[model samples]
Target: MNQPPLPEVLDLAGEHFHTDQYATYRDILEQRPVTRVRFYDGSLVWLVNRYEDVRAALSSPRLSNDPTQQTDIDLSAATGIPDDLSEYFRRNMFRSDEPDHGRLRKLVTREFTVRRINAMRPRIERITEDLLDKFAATGGGDLVGAFARPLPLTVMCELLGVPEEDRTDFQTWSQHVVESDPAFAERNAASYRSLFECVRSLVRRRRDEPGEDLLSALVEQRDAGDRLSEAELISTVFLLLVAGIETSVNVIGTGAFLLLTHPGQLARLRADDALMGSAVEEVLRYMAPIEMTSRHSLESVEIGGVSIDAQSTVLINLAAANRDPARFEDPQSFRVDRNDGSHLTFGHGIHYCLGAALARAEAEIAFGLLLKRFPGLELAVPTEELTWRHVFMRGPVALPVGWR
Candidate 1:
């Protein structure tokens, strides 16, 4: 059987925010919606970059989110965690399929309803204001380090009742897991182990003394019935901690960068605080934090005019899809008032992000508070000098800003 020539491997995992890369995605969208592209580690997956195709593929039940079916890569072998940690990681809903996914997600999602998130606005504002108070002291600093990064990490930890003392450690471990370099793959194991231990200890504590917190609710549900397993409990907590922090952190950082660069739109947003809702959606569409996600075909299925064999890998480039010309009028430009919130940044179908409401609330509060406080905020360094980390969720490494 002769195979077709593979498409040029796009380095979507590495350096982001490049013109040439987006140009390639646009080219792919127009020509080849579904094609094979090599990941940074030389692994090839069926890359789906078109807007319509990406949405269809994401919602298709024939394609499963379970990576266990992808024989091409042993995910555990790559991460190299201990058996207990590995098992816990496997139980996480991010990789779950069907019945188990519904069961696990149901147990934890009550804490993440839009109303619940809306209720947290006062607390979220307090945190945002406190962060700004410190930022105001120096008048300028890396917004990522000072404001973007810490804001979500703190909010999530506080919500889960994580000790004020251990929030920093939690942030460090979570970042290492997602942003790990291929060179430091071995260190990745230790990071997971540390996080696992921390989460396990927290679970145990919640059992002993239940409180007005998400973890306590989870612990109570675990005790009540067969609805949640022990490992699932730990994994759910882990997922909430990581997902809640990672997505919102990137949104705040990336959203702020887009606004800072597109001052006209920023001014428009500032002038009318009523536009905050649309503004956040526009930011998400402009620069998705989690650029790509992969799924394994459950059976031989057709996607984007290509026949994918059973157990084949499918990688959907959400960032590229969000920017597809077919979807938006001027996909390249950043507009704060863009009304559509159809971006696949959080994903689609059953696997859509559980903490989306939380992410949205955080962004709305973070942006609203920051703009109100630092009306003079602007980049401290030239745009070219700004460094972006090639993490699973891409955002500025250090978004230095100055306020007049």
Candidate 2:
């Protein structure tokens, strides 16, 4: 049998990757479904672009999420995370495979169930209202800073029993960890250290006091048996903090931007309140918060006719897959009532996002109440003037909007 041709190599970094990512993905999906792309720090990975390829790559057993599985790469060093501290940061379910992944996921699966998340709706609404009340008082501000960032951060912090006063520190530390900017690279280790230390303190407190929060529950499980370890516990909290907060923040911020920019969809949604759920799904698909996720190929695998060697890194472009024309009708257009829910924004198979339900509920409440309260909401500045965060996740750094 003949081997497939090597994938074309391309550089994807700086302004183009951050600002016009969709266009770049489109070109790759149309031409090179699988290509090797060099990232900011000069690390190379096989970039899978098409919908089918991305979906297959995400669920393929051949692709492993474990950093330790990579034979040729020091993932921690490549990503600027210290080798010694990498285990604490990467021990969570998202970075695991097989029995360990299942074990870690099972521990927190119940907490994020649709039922549990729905029960928190009332509290989520109240939080939204409190933030909106402040926004209304000011009449306009950076929606991200004033509302989008805080609402989810507050929810995650409260869920983890993080003290109110400690949230600022948590936000700063998480931002440093998630930001993809080269400037933020040097701070990654320090941020991870801080986050681990903070989580350790919280874990100790939860073990002693045992509050009604998820951290307390996790601590109970850890103490009850060997079901959970100290490192895993800390990592779980870290995952929930960074993953839970950032995804929802982007959804709220980018969702708002999408609605405001696409007035027709916004108007359609406003006219028919029933479209809120569909609108949320569309926002998720159209502007995926987590753009791409990397996995280590456990063995040699063929994707989109390109062969990936054993222990090679593969980056599945979720944003590209979500908007692939082959899967979505008018993939470029944002429609409130598209009602198509097959997008891989929450991923698929074993590693599907654990916080999907909570993120959706928070977004629905945030947008529903936001539109209801401020019917006149519009961009505070020209759309081109708005800046996006160049991070592991994609969202506006600040969404300035005014309801007046």
Candidate 3:
């Protein structure tokens, strides 16, 4: 089968933000689950859009997550970002393979475990109530700016032992790294400086006077056994700060938007507490935050009738795969009662999101409380009128919602 043209990939991305690409994604999955396309820098890569193909691609040992192994595809060439910014990305767990990925992931997984996350539920509920209370006083507000953004950032800052006074700066820095457009190089540099300096200061403070937070725990572990390196410490903080904030914010923000927009789905979820977990899963599947993640083939592999060469780049379209009609019924509709867990939003295999439990806990508290607190909640603006961030990891820029 002939591969999709370069423009098709770009067109798909463009269509995704402006309109739902459910039909296009379904067509791609059915026609060419593992098809090749050119990235922004004009390098060709296999783009997988089917759930099974994406899961296989993620788990395949023939594929490597380490960008260092992808010498043929320069980070700058592939992403249209300066090579200097690549160093910041390369140091992180997201770009690492096993042993390294496992090591970094283990350092924080204990804190993000299901038990710890669930334990934080009451506190999360308190925090959600407090934020909603403030919003209630204002009559109407930008839900994303007023509630969604601050809630996750506050939780992450608290987890990492970051001081309250310094969180705003960190939030600004992290956003720059994720949305590094208009001027990718300069924004990333600023992000890196803020992040490194903040983490370094926190690490020093924790070393001197350890606290009860997760960062303090990690610091104590490092000091006691010399298990983690200085580089790992900073890199782990970077991961937590970036991943912690971006994923939670988008998940909560987008999930609420979906619920509000789909009244029938919202009604069902509100009527039954038993459906909240399934609602959360459907939310993750239907409005996946991270659209695509890249991996490189370590050896030649055949997938979906195409032979992917060794060292070839492969991009898993999480959004596309989750919406595959093969695995989902009425995939385009935001039905919370669907109760399917076949989503790739948290990824698959070993590279699955370590913070999945924590994110879900936060979202559950967020949406459950949101509906209860604002039973009269309704969108202040039309769906088409609301602005959306035009990026791979997409979310509503501002959700103007009103309630009595």
Candidate 4:
């Protein structure tokens, strides 16, 4: 039997979600849902492909997110992330387990509740319409830069009470934090330092002059009973800013790209407003922002007949899991009618995404108003020529579009 193309086979697949490779990966899944492979650093990792297995591994108590519990596996050394950059990810809810995760998540959960997100719909709709107006006036523009990137940045800025004037600076900081090029260590360091300093300033200001925003609330919590430490506050803000902007930006860009490319799905969503919610779900499934997540095994474990040793790195193939043929029929096809919410795009169980609701809200309004306002919207350039950001998250760098 032919084996699937390993990471060695396709070097750039790490940054770009090569859907074309899923066919080969699907075949691998049939043999064993979890397969061991060597990463670029020659470090071994278990790739979890099957949807059920991915979900199971994510929710399993055996899996440890706590860096303390797991053996030494420095993300900085492994990924070329500098000490300070890695400091941003050192410890928090995402890397913590159980009580810590629950406590940290609860502290900020109220700010992102479904109702709160829904309340922002009217404001989001206004933001969408205003952005569409700019695109409409220009006849055609780069949708990713003009619309997709700005909408989420705007929402996050408002939620965090960041002044509108500071958003441009904030965007610059975020781009560097997620930089994929391991070669540019000096450039990455400069940007990482700038971003850290910016966040620190914001935290200090919030501490001095508390406000209605999340940062202030968190600062108050920290001051009261030491609910959040300075490091935790910085990490939470960094996570919210990066995860908030990047995911929504790509979702809008990729979802819009898919809609424009798939006339049938576009028409289905355009004709019915009620289908907007499910349409967003399909878009998310089709274009998962965070394609993969890294996890390290706490102890030796048996998965798919293969023995994964303790301290082994693991890769959860989220993009592949969402498109697994075993779970969904015509997995490659873009179907707005599909109602399966089992997609691991936002992850599963305890590690489920905290910003899922806010993301859905932003996309629902952004896409809904986009189609309604510019019915003639079509790609300005040939799809093949469009540049894709070859990062952990994939999206068109610039989605230029034209309309009547």
Candidate 5:
């Protein structure tokens, strides 16, 4: 097949891209479905914009999640993990392919099973109420800081048996680790070291004194057999802590922001409790927590009629795919009851998020309790003044909300 000429490389690290992503995505999806984009660090990746192409790229065997498979590109540098800590940070399932991905995922899959997640409902509710009680007492504050951020942090810490006293430090380190700004490179590296040492210490504690927590179970798995190595064990815990907490925080915060911004949708949800599930799904589709994910092409591949060279980085824009008009009707519109199809927010294929079920459960409980408690809930500040975090994970830094 004759390949189409590549489009001009666009800059994706600019403030415009961060401030108005959906608009930028819409333009790309329509005019340049398959193109290359340059990041702030001058690294280039082929950007897949349309829904079908993004979905196909995500599941294609030719695209490998493991960075080591790429020969031409230095993915290790792209990851921004300091050299000394790279082994500890990059050895998890999220960054692996094939047998290794399956093995690492299997070790913790049961803990996030539907049955296990469902079992967490009572405790999740209690945590939600406790957070809400504090918010209610103050009348209102930055919802993201006071409620959304802490809810998942608290849940994840409790699940992993992280000491209550250490949670503040953990949260601080996590924020630094996940920040994508080049200015924070030094801080990010320092945070990576801090996080690695912290998880390593937790692993030792779990090994010496096993508890009923998930981390302890993983520690036991390592001790009982050679199933998991020390690096793998600690890395898996780190992945769980960062991935499990940050994504949920984005979902809950973004979900509430969507609800407050779309009054009609909020009104419909308030009137019909059955719309809760669909509402959450809509939020995921409309404003995906993680906007884009990256993979490396192991072999030359064609997507949307554009041929990509082997070892080339390809970025799947989840937020753009979710809003592709080819897959969704009125894709830009936010509707609580609309059930077009499943969105790629939790993604598809082998690398689908393992904590998806848990995130959904937390969001449902959080929103249900929130609306019930504050029927008049609304944004406390002008929408234009709100600031979003410029990172892979998308959410407002602080959502000041009020209810009277």
Candidate 6:
């Protein structure tokens, strides 16, 4: 009912994750911590910038994660999913709330037990080695495209039973799905259809001819009990492919950037292999790729000392929260040995990232291999020249690197 008094309109468009942007968020946090801003799609959303407010909103049951409840955002255009399939996409655990979210998370969490994830170490390392073999051959290459993109993509595809044929050339579509650039706000509906249709076909095929893959296991779960639905089956596959690939890809890409830029930390990590876990956690904290997520107010709730009415759209700034001076000491600096991995990088609450462990494992292994293989690795292009994308699934578009 009121307008943003000139300064409240923040851009969530195709803007690079520039340093000044963080300062802007810091300013917002210090002043109106819980305020409104317009997203790139011309959709107005309540932006929560302060650490406590963001953390509370992320886990608060009073705020709903269901995209269908959102009146401000045009879900159809933003997500690039058709009407029939949009419901399935929206019902995915990431977007679902309550018992449904719990059930979906429970089923997937069972599949990611320590034993199962540990078993994949060999395969993950093997994939990283194979990718490194190629990267080293190029004397260096675009790390994002060459190594970061394919390694996790291969691992996720193989683990989820997504055929190799369906994995290539799909990143651009997923990137658009996560971001809304004013210049390219027009989403490619065809590409989105092909993506979902491909996954849907794979789901059906897995049912008819099950395999020893995670998707088949999920299919078995669906068949054994009414716990999983057809829509959910598609949605799970959708999440594993999109979030699994995208999340891990950006973490690996940017994690490498961190090591490259902060050589002292890089040297410290290289000196000790045990720091791999801590280093990964530090990277997640320092620069959470999924900078922000939304929650629709289920009831009138007080956040950041301000009472927000029910049904109001709220944006939780994960990146800002991760770097909050109150939560983290010298939050701006990158520390490889920052053992206190309590940052809300993977998020908090029931909606905490399902694939967080897997993402961490991949990054640790990927970074370790890079340290061992490319001792003197440095950015092929200057840092300022790097391209960043997506207000949501964000990361360097192309990470060119060279090494001795």
Residues 123-152, model 2: lDDT tens digits:
999999999999899879899999999999
TM-score of each: 0.94, 0.96, 0.92, 0.92, 0.96, 0.93
Roughly what TM-score does model 2 have, to 2 decimal places? 0.96
Which residue runs of candidate 6 sit more than 4 Å off their true CA positions? 1-6, 14-19, 169-172, 182-185
TM-score of model 4 vs. true structure = 0.92
Question: lDDT by residue for model 5 over 325-349, one digit each (tens)?
Answer: 9999999999999964489998889
CA lDDT of each candidate? 0.82, 0.87, 0.79, 0.77, 0.87, 0.80
Per-candidate clashes come to 0, 1, 0, 0, 0, 0
User: Against the true structure, what is every candidate's RMSD?
Assistant: 3.4, 3.4, 2.9, 2.5, 3.0, 3.3
Model 4, position 113, has a per-residue lDDT of: 95
Question: What is the Cα-based TM-score of model 6?
Answer: 0.93
lDDT of 1 by residue, 1-404 (tens): 33333246555444322444666667677667787765546666788888888999888988888766677755655455565567687787888898889988888778788888888889989989999999899868888888888998988888889988888888888887775355666777888999988998998888899899888888888898757888888888888888788888889998888899988999899889999999999888888888888899989998878998987878888988999988898999888878999999989988999888888889999999999888888998989898775534678878989988
Error of 3 at 351 (Å): 1.2
Clashes of 1: 0
RMSD of model 3 against the true structure: 2.9
TM-score winner, 5 or 6: 5
